[model samples]
Every structure is written in C-alpha cells, then in structure tokens.
Target chain A: MTTTAVDILGADDVSRAITRISHEIVERNPALDSVVIVGMQTGGTWIAKRLCESVNKIVEGANVPLGAIDISLYRDDYSLRPVVLSAPTDIPVDLTGRTVVLVDDVLFTGRTVRAALEALNDYGRPRAVQLAVMVDRGHRELPIRPDYVGKNIPTHFSDEVAVGPNGVTVSAVAT
Target chain B: MKHLLDTHDLSIDDIVNILDVADRMAEVNRRQVPKVPALKGKTIATVFFEDSTRTRLSFETAARRLSADVLTFLASSSSVNKGESLRDTIETLSAMGVQAFVVRHKSSGVPLQLSQWTDASVINAGDGWHQHPTQGLLDAYTITREFGTPTSLAGRTVAIVGDIKHSRVARSNIDLFTRLGARVVLVAPPSLLPSHVETWPVDVRSTMDDVIDNVDVVYLLRMQLERMQSASIPNLAEYTRLYALTPERAAVLQDHALLMHPGPMNRGVEITVDPADVAGSRILQQVTNGVSIRMAVLFTLLGGDSVSSLTAGGEA
Candidate 1:
C-alpha cells in the first residue's frame, strides 16, 4: 500500500486549539497555580511552551513551572522501533502533589503517553496526570485517552502525523 | 556500539557518535534526581576475572541508575575459585539470559572470547594490556564536554604519559583520541615504553618535559609499580623525577589544557597530588562520565537501535 503526505491543519488551527486547551486546563484546576506543564522533547516542547504562555495570560499571578521529558528510555518497543537518542530530561519543578499536564504533538498508539507516564514516575508521584495533545489520530492500541485535545484527525493505520509549530502534516508511503 | 571490545573497532564517525550519545547520558548523572528507565527490563552481568575497585563499581552503578537488574561475579569467590574455566562461568550466566556482559579479565581477548560464546553484548572493562573501551569513551566524552564540541579535538594534541607498556587505558585512548583527530604522543622511560611503540600511531619521547609545553591535554597513566618488578626501573623516586607530573610541570601546561588520569594512582610516583588536583583536572569527571558512557553502550547494543543511531541526536 503506497501512502501519501498531506497538510491537515494550518498555524491558526494550532494556535486556536492551544488556546482552548489552555482554557480547559485552567477550568479543570481552578487556581492553575499547582499545575505543572511538561512537554515531550523535539515535538511537544514548543506546543507546551505556547500552552503555558496561554495558561499564564488567562490567570493572574501567572507563573506555572515547565519541564521536558525524553521518553525514549521508557519506551517498551526497543526491539521493534527505531530508538530515539537520549536527551536531557529536565524536570524543573517537584511533581509531588502538583497536577502534571503532560503535553505531546500527536496522540496515536498511546504508547508514547504510556512511556511518558512511566518516565514521570521516576521523577516523583504527581497529584494526577492529564494528557494534552494537539492532534488525536485515534488508533490507540492501549486504553489511553487525552484529557484535552486540539483536533481529532482520524487516520489510516499506516499514515503518520507530524505536528510542528507552523502546522500539522500526515504522511505515509504513497500507494 | 555492539560489543565495545576495543577502540580499534571505532571509526572517526563511530567515536564521535559515542561521544554525542554520551552527552545525553551525562545529563542523567548531573540531573537533580540521578536515575533513568533506559534499561528497565534488562539484566546486566558484571564479570570481573581480575581485581577492580572502580570499573566494576562504576559499571554496576551505571546499570542500576538506568534501572537495569545487575548480577555481579567476582573471580575470587565465584565458581572460577572452584576450578571452573572462564568459558564455563560465562556459558552458565548466558544460560540465564543477561542482555549484556561487562567483562574485565586479567588476560587479553577474554571479552572477545566471551562475545563469541553468547549473543549478549560484551563490554571490555579492562582486558590485560589491551583495550578499555569504556575508559577511552568516558575520557573522550569528558574532553568533548569540556570543550563543548565533539569535533574540536581534530587539531589538538593529547599526550599519554607513563606506563605505556602495562596500561590498557593508554592503548585505548590512543585509538580513540587519534580517531577523533588529535595528535597523540607517548612519553615514558625507555624501559617503560611498549615494545611496539614505533608501530602505534603516536610519537615517543624519553621524557614528558620534552613535549610537555606543547600539548592540549596531559593524560597520565598510572605507574604500575607491581609490573615494574621485573623491569629495569630502579626506584619510585627515579620514576617520579623522570615522569611524575609535579607542580612545576603542571604550571607549564598550555592555557585551557586539561590533566586527566584513569585512577587508582601511585600519587607521589607517577603524579603528585597538586597536579592531579588542578582546577581543570578531568580525573574525577572521567569517573563520573563512565556510568553514562556505559549506559549509552548498553542501550545502543541491546535496544535494537542500529549502531549508526548513536550519531543521530547531537548535531556536533
């Protein structure tokens, strides 16, 4: 099956989705002071920054700490997938009792999120974890769900979605 | 990345790749919380057929911090004490399915032999007067970290001084440093120099002071007084006066130059305490970087990641 690449969303949609995600986050945890935002490296990093900025602008006293995690080490499929290189996992704030809003670009097999959760456990116990994603490509092999999602772009099992600062694109071998 | 038996197996690209991945591994050591889940389900066997204070402990710590289950075998108390051959011990452990074996043997080529005996990766911790690949790797990683560039050593000079005949660290470093594009030199007494010094990819000098002022890094190898027993070196004072890094020699180092040592030093003999304790000394840093380098080695070999992937993340 030859697959193809196509632009799915533009910058405006991403920006709007993040703003909505920011609102949902603030409403879920009323004060927003105890919520910590963490981005998955290389992709979730930028979106998490934008989300944190939006979250700060919505509430007074503004400061919500941020950190980044490299879930490559926590991955379960080292025997199956091309491994991602290790990056500095800088968790700036203590996660104990703080609400961690885990951020990522695309929510697919739920494996990445699963790895992220396992990685975070090494840091410390969080009050709770709520996943936020810019795109939900909906073929989750694991029974996992994102609490705040920007757009739901259902895709073929073979296609891959890549979310960047400017926009999002889905690609697969051209069939 | 698979079975780091020696630095000779590494190309410039392979050497640089190990350093780049080591950059990420080094972060785990420096993190506020010193642990990672990189090798969570993996089992690592540290088989030391020789006495070791640092390499054995460092490998065990590195494995543990990465969350890997560790099984240690010391030759003195193990079945090897009961007359079992090295092959028997290894095959016994391989039977239990360790993903990797960090082997340090008194004889050269044991790591290579063990690698042949099992599918598990074999890391040469220290094998006779052969290769100590991880030591070479951590040293490169330390230098790369200090300079903030992996390729910056291309034109630099690194002098490995003392005990060239008996030091495996010297052998591995020469292979690694030269591959990373550094000019290497060996400085030791005539009796202490290796038999094949002319064949190695480095210059040889009768004394360190001859080229001491020109090098970017002055790497000192521990003077194996134990091995010098049958050699012609008469006394410790003679060895010190000729090769020991004294306070005066330390002052002559080029600006920004570093001093590195693979530890368990004969302090007053090969190097004085003052020179070793200098501001830019990379001795302690080498020890700390050991864990991360080994972590990268174990991960790349067993993670099903192609060895080429070691060069993937860091742009430099």
Candidate 2:
C-alpha cells in the first residue's frame, strides 16, 4: 500500500491552539476550582497535562486535578476489532458535582468520546462533562461532539489524522 | 489465545500481555464502581466438576465485574448424578449461547474435551493435576509486581515446596515462571514428586533447607490428601518437619524474599507459620490478584476479537 503524508498543523500552530483552548476552558468554566481535566489514554495524555499546566499558569495557585482514562474496556468494537488495554486509569479526585474536560488527540467517529463518557461514570457523577480534541476530522457515527476543538480539517474516510507534540499530520492511504 | 487450556500454549508476548492487562484490571478493581462494561451482554458459565471455593468465586466475581452474566454449574447438584454426560451438559450450554466456559474438573483433559465439543472458548480453571493456567499467571503477576519488573523475572529464582506430582498449580507455574526467565527449584519428597520429573525444566531439592535462604520466592503447594490414594509421605508430622514453611526456615529467608501459597493452605501441614506474621508474605495479595488476573483472562477470551492481535507488540 502507498501513502502520502502532509503536515496539517505546524508545531507552533499546535502550541497556539493549546494555549487558546486553555484560555477558553478558564473563560467558559468560571469555577476553575471545580474543573478537572482527563485525557484519553495514549494519545491525549500529553495534551491533557499540557492543558492542565497552561490552565494553572493562567490562574495563580490553582491546583486543578488531572487524570488519564483508558477507554478500551468501554468501546463497542470488541466483536469487530481486537481490544487491548493501553494504560491504567488514574482519576485523582471525585468528579461528583464537578466539571470534567475530556481531552483526546483526534476526534473522528465520536465513538471514543462515547466510550470515554461511559468510563467516566465509573469514577463519579460529574455535574457536567465536556470534550476537547486537537483535530476534528468529522465522520461522527454517534451524537457526540467536542466542546473545544483545536482544528477541524475535513478528510476522506480513509485519511488518517495523527496528532503529536511535533505537530499534526494527515496520511492519505491509497484506496 | 482463543482458548486458554494451558500456560504451555502462551508465548512470552501472551504472558506479558495478560499481565499488562491485569494491571489495568487491578486499577478497575480499585475504582469506586469496581466494574466495567467490557463484557456486557456476554455470558460466562463456570462448570466446576471438582470442589473449589476460591477459583469458582474469583471467576464469578471477575465475570460480574466486567458486566458479563455468569452461570454456575456444580457437578454434585447438576444432572451428572442423573447420568448426564459431560458432552450433553456442554452442548446444552453452548446451545444457550454461552460465550465462554471456566472449567474445573477432577479428571484431566475435561476442559480440552469440552473445547472440542463446543464452539465457545474454554478456560481451564483447573483440570485435575494437569494445569491451572490462571493460577500460574496470577502467581507470575504477583512476583513480577513485587519485584517491580513489569515484563520478566529474568534472574529471579523461585523455590516451589511440596506435592509436585498432584499439584496443577505447580505444573502451570513451572511453565510460566520458566517462560518469564525464572529459575525454578522443586522442593519435594521423592514419593511426592512427579514420575517424569527429569523432563521438567527445574532443579530438584529433597528438602526446603537446601534452597530456603537463596530463592527470591518460596511457593507452597497444598497437599492433596484426597489424591494421595496411598502414603506419599511417612506421616503429616514428618511432612511438616521437612517441607512446611516453619518459623525457623522463614527466619532464614532473605529480607526481600517473598512467601506465596496457592490458597486453602494446610495451616500445620505446608505452612506452620502464620501468614500475617511473615513480613514478606503475599498470600493475601495472591488472592486479591486472582480476581484481576481472571478478569484479564475472561475479558481477553470473550471481550476481544483475537488474542494474537490484542497481544501484538507495539502501542495498543
């Protein structure tokens, strides 16, 4: 199989997007003390930590709880594909009556977000839940949507959008 | 990968994969809910043809925690007494859409036979003295976690004490520990040792005193009195004097050396000392880890498409 890779968002652009999203998080959720950030495992953990750091920097003496969740157990594709656990879920604080911001690297079919939502319930009942993603490649199979998106780059179903600390790249596999 | 009949069927990759997933399952066990939707709508039937308390409950708890329905079958209460064959029971359950079978039988190869007769995945909880793969995995998981090594026990040494011939746990652990790069020493009387012990990948010790102070782990096996059939030892007192994890021998162990026992420990026969008093004892941790390991097994067999792909190298 042949593939073509193109850089979608440069490193500087990705940084700017994270900074902007962090500001939006603080601005929208006035009660930053009650807000927690949880990253979807493997891909979104780094971004979640970065977002937490940026959020704390924007607010003095703010100690926002950060966690990482592996949603493999809650996914609906067990019969269709292999399911392997990625990382241990580490929710440091009870989410009851607090807001949760779920971070992920890419948002494509919205199925991962759905699984993340179910995974969150095992932690605690949060007052509200929100989604944050670096890339929204738009092929949603569910009624889920991201609250804060860094970039929305539409692509074909076969295109793969990968987000990393370096940047974001969209690989087009020959069909 | 499809059916976990024995530890001999697992590759290094498979063992590591199950241990890694068990870590995740351990975290789930620590959760506020202590449950997941991984195996929702999937049904698991535990068919115990032999007597067991811990293994049966552990599998049932693991299945429930994963949100999978459980069907409990005991030979004593079931139609087996009414002359129903094992094949009839397995086929009946298969027709009822059982996704997996956690089988424990007094006769060896019962799980393997069931696998041949059914389409559902067969997990051999314990089949006579043939194999208890989950016990092996949990024991390996316990040791690996204690040593703070996530993958292998490359240079670690384990001394398994007592009843090697009739111990399914011993058979499974030997396969698993060696596969994970651990040197195993079997400490048992010649009468209690397996007939083909020379073929096994382990060193043989006639007494615990020979290897008590050196090994990283001291594993005690239960004495199968029922299976003894004849006098395997002179007497229980002599057996305890030679093989039990007595306080004198326990005191000689290295400070970091671990004490382990597959449960229903014969208090005065195999381990005379109080497990709680032993500073390095992981007897309870082994029981706790059983749930996590079995959860990993159940989820691996029923909640995934293929074990090979799930355990394949690289980022999951």
Candidate 3:
C-alpha cells in the first residue's frame, strides 16, 4: 500500500477555524462567566490556549479558566496500548455548576474523550460538558460528538491526520 | 517495568518517569474527591507477611484512590497460621484474579520469590534489609519537590545517618540517590556498617559531625529494634551521643538543608530534636508523598499494556 501525504488545511485555515469556533461558543453559551475551558494534555494544550485567547477577544473581560487533563489514567485501552502519562491535570476552580468546554486537537476514536469525561467527574460535577476539536476525522468507536468542530474531514480508518499550529495534514493510501 | 522489586532494576529514566507520574498523582490527591477510575475492575492484594502500620495503609490508600479493589491478607489472620505453604497461599490469591500483589516480608527477596509462583505483578513494600523501592522513590520525590525541580538533586549531597547495616531504607536510598546524581555519605558505627560496604557506591563517615554542615539533605534511618538480633551498638546513650540528630547538630545544618525521616521515628535514638520544631523537616511530607509514589507504582504495574506481554517468571 502506497501512502500519500496531503495538506488538508493551511495555517490560515486553522486560525480562521479557531475564530469561528470561538464565535460559536460565545453565541451558544451566553453566560461566559460560568464557562471554563479545559484542554486535553499534550496535543490539545496548544489549541485550547488558542481557543481561550480567541474566546477572550470575542467578549472583552472574558477570563475563562484554562485547564489541562491527562486521560492516561482514565483510558479504556490500557490493555490494548502502552499507557504513558503526560502533563498533570490542573483544574483551577471547583467545576460544579459550570459549563466545561473541553478542547482537543483531533477527534477520531472518541476513546480519549470517553476517558476525559471520566476524569472530569473526579473534580466536580459540571452543569454541562462540551467538546471542541481542531479536526473531526470520522472514525468514532464511542457515541461521542464534538460540539464545536474546526473541520469535518472524512477519511479512511487507516489514514492518519496530524494537527499542528502550521496546518492539518492527512496521510492516506494512494489509489 | 512490570514489578517493583528494587532500585537496582530501575534506571534513572524509569526513576524520573515514576516521579513525573507521582506529580500527577499528587494533583489527584489534592482534589476534593481524591479518586479516579483508572483501575476500577482491577484488584490489588497487599500480602504482608510481617507487621506494618504506614506501608500497608499507604499502599492500600494509593490503590483505593486509583479505584482499585484492595484485598488485605494479613499473615497473622490468614491460613498461613494453619501451615499453608507460601506457594499455596499465593496460588489461592492468584485464583481470585488479583492483578497485582504488594508483598512485605521480614525476609529479603520474598517478593522476588513470590513473583515466580504467580503471574501477578509484585511490589516489594519492604523485604528484610534488602530494599524498599517505593520508599526510595518517595524520598527522591520529596527531595525533588523541596529543591523545586525533578533533576535538582544532581549536584547535591545527602547524608544517610544511623543503622546502615539493617536499614532497607538506607539500602534503597543509596541506590536511588546516587543514580539521580546525588552523592550519598553513609554515617554509622563500624559494627552497624554492612560487611561488604566497600563494594557499595558511597562515601563512608563515622559520625554526623564529619559531614553535618556540608550536606544538602540529612536522611535519618530508624533503628529497627526487631531486626537487631545482636547488639550492634554499645548502648542507646552512647549511640545518641555519637550519631543522633541532636539540637546542636541540627543547628549546625545549613538553612537550605532539608531533614527527612522514613517514619515511625525513633525519637531519642536516631532523631533527638522534635521534627515539628525544625523548619526544614519533611517527615510528614515523606508520608504524604508515599501515597503518590505508591499510586504511581501501582498504576505503572497494573494499568499498562506492557506488563501483560512480559513473562512474570523472569527475575524482576
């Protein structure tokens, strides 16, 4: 099988996606004070920072609490994959009675989001939990959907999608 | 990677990784609800052949916080009193689908021996005077936290004081501290020193006065009354005079120097000053860090996909 790499989204597209998602978040949730943004560790950390920055610009004086969670402990695939821990989970405030906006880099198997949901319960019960991702590549093993999506790029199961500050690239099998 | 038998099996990278995970576990422990579903379906059986207060409770608490089911097997209450063989007892627990075993025995290498009889991951809580790897890791973690960096102990010097011959804490820390690039100086009487001390990687000092002010950390070891079959020291008063962390010696310590004790401390024998009064004492922190370090060990052994691939029959 021959693999071909193609740039699915450019750097400008990535920036615009954040701006659009930030607007969508502000439009859907009127009470910005009750909203908190949490990024998944490693991959989602940078995107979450950017999302928080974009949301802050959309509404002046919107100080969203940015946090990060490492779901290595809460994963369902410890038996299937090597479970390596990442950065520490830092939830700055009591998450009870607050709407949590969970941000991630990519949405594929949805297993990581499942683990993230379980991890959130340990902090405090949130009023509502919403997921935001940079890329939704369409192979979800769980019944999880991203509320705010950057780009819905449908691809094969074997194809790989890499998200970065530069752009989103997909490596697919050549026809 | 599979079982935590001793510090010898842990490389500097493995030690650093465990400490890093321990930092995360520390975060979880600080939460309002200090629990995670990491090991919900998994069970950890703490099979202690000897008596304990903190080590057993610490391991159990670590497992419980991680949402792992804990089965406590006390040697006194169990069928072992009815002459059940070690193999039979282990087989019994292994039949119950235990994924991990935290074994503490009065004899050295019992956990290593037990790992052979079962496929479960074995953690050596304390085995005679051989090693206590988690304690080593926790002590290292405590120092790392004090210094404000994970690899900050690289240039620092640590002095291990009292009962070097029969102290598993000293044995383990000597390996762990030196591996993390800290110079360890062992302070004890000639009789209390191990027989083959020359082969070990450390500096030897006879009294605390020799290296009192120069060290970065002073780690006190408990004088195990039970382990002392023969009188290694002349008397408690003489031992205290010669080696105990008295007020004068404590005053001689640098302001930046930290005091650490693996607890249930022998106040008059090893540490004479009140730990509470000392500004640099980390005794209580050692107890607190033990939970996080054990959680790291338990999660590393049971929650990973690597252990399932490795044959448990090989040496740990």
TM-score for all predictions?
A: 0.92, 0.95, 0.95
Q: Which DockQ values do the candidates obtain, in the order shown?
A: 0.35, 0.48, 0.46
- Per-candidate clashes come to 6, 0, 0
Q: State the weakest 10-residue window (summed lDDT) of model 2 chain A.
A: A76-85
- Among residues 3 or more apart in sequence or in different chains, the pairs in candidate 3 whose N, CA or C atoms overlap within 3 Å are none
Cα lDDT tens digits, model 1, B250-315, are 888887899998988777888885754577688887888888898777777776644443331111
Greater TM-score among 1 and 3 belongs to 3
Model 3, runs deviating above 4 Å: B226-229, B307-316
Candidates 1 and 2, the one with greater DockQ: 2
Model 2 segments more than 4 A misplaced: A1-4, A173-175, B227-229, B306-316
DockQ-best of 1 and 3: 3
lDDT of 2 by residue, B193-234 (tens): 999899999999999999999999999999866645688887
Identify the leading candidate in terms of DockQ: 2
lDDT, candidate 1, at B118? 89
- Model 1 residue runs over 4 Å out of place are A4-6, A171-175, B275-277, B305-316
**Candidate numbers sorted by DockQ from highest down:** 2, 3, 1
lDDT of 3 by residue, B155-220 (tens): 999999988898898999999898888999999999989998999989999989999989999998
